[model samples]
Target: MSSRFVFSIMTLLMTLISTSSAQAITLRGEIQPDRYTYYLTDQYAQKLWAMNRDRNRTIRFNLPPGELVAQTDVSFAYQHPAPTAITCISSIYYNQGARANWLKVACIDNNGLEYSTHQKWPDTSIAKRVCKVGEASCDAFLTMSSDNWSGPQ
Candidate 1:
């Protein structure tokens, strides 16, 4: 992705993050498809900003009151996932009354198939999402204790 594109994403993130005091915002860097690692660059308020290899989308998360993005309990369970070869991922967060804390994840699988879903932050139910996005391996959702085990759920 162009540095200008990346700069724009960072600027936008900083704007939103700076304005929100009601919720904590967490954004993830994109995966460098070739390196299979996070493409991290730029920082603000100690936060890192990045766009995916595809440079198409970005994602954010908002946790409950008093929770912080830096907290392991929160970020580990909800942050943008680590990069993988199976797919490229991006996400967005919406806050339109009643829709607050909703996160929509957009993915493009290795096959170039598109998939997306919106769910409330910090889901506490036993029902885990079962679908495929960006990654060919289905484990796109950040599951606590789950390693890089990519497989269709």
Candidate 2:
């Protein structure tokens, strides 16, 4: 091939590669024992922002399938002495809102424990939701565990 042709091809490839890869995102936030107990009312936005912004944030992850994205401001807590090390994975999936297959997200906190919850809404993409506890897992709603040293529920 000619030198000019080779140079043009290489330039095109470089441009395409650079254009395809956008800037890196950063996510950040805070979780408390009180607010974290029952899934936060703003967990959706908080997780999204953490994945898309706030550069140095921890717990970066993606959602699973059939999980609709909704906005809310409830609270939920975690059980732990926190893992010594953690991993964050992010992915996109469909959240079937009684309507259809819509894109949603799941942020898993693999910190030596499992903390899973779900929220529903009219639109999966739009931010605005009604939070529901354990509905995603097909489990009972949030409740104080029956087994407790302090007392009984």
Candidate 3:
């Protein structure tokens, strides 16, 4: 093979590898009605396994309240504690309606610990709170409350 042809092949291979590795994996799933339990698709599980191989600490992502739906994509942020370290979710709530009606959502960690946020109309800012890290696995969903809305207003 010509030297130039060999160089071109190596460059192409390198580019392919870099491109594939740079792509991030996103996990999609739904928070079941059970509220505390969540189900992840097989693809999500596989992707999580691949991503977790390089990590030593458990990771959690604070998904936006709007994104909690029948099906949602869950992606981890760059900021995470060691897989074994303690961490929690900080939430902020704002009033999303004009009436006295309010909505509160809670995220439950693997250990049954719950972090909640309350929002009333006109208060668009998220309420903030943190729950100490619990088990190795974590999941979150909206809890049914007087202020909870069946859907986005």
Which candidate comes out best when scored by TM-score? 2
lDDT of 2: 0.32
lDDT of 3 by residue, 9-74 (tens): 999999997775233212123212322233434443333334433344333445444322111112
* Model 1 residue pairs with clashes: 58-91, 59-91, 87-134, 87-135, 108-134, 109-134, 138-151
Q: Could you tell me the lDDT of residue 27 within candidate 1? A: 35
lDDT of 1 at 97: 72
Report the Cα lDDT for residue 85, model 1: 20
lDDT of each prediction vs. the true structure? 0.34, 0.32, 0.34
Q: For candidate 2, give the lDDT of residue 121.
A: 18
* Candidate achieving higher lDDT, 1 or 2: 1
**lDDT tens digits by residue: candidate 2, 1-153:** 999999999999999888653322222222211111123235443554343333443442454433332221111112222222111222233344554333222232222222222232123342333233334432222223432447654
Backbone clashes in candidate 2 total 25
Ranking, TM-score, top scorer first: 2, 1, 3
lDDT of 1 at 67: 19
Model 1 regions lying over 4 Å from their true place:
1-92, 120-153
CA lDDT of 125 in candidate 1?
Answer: 25
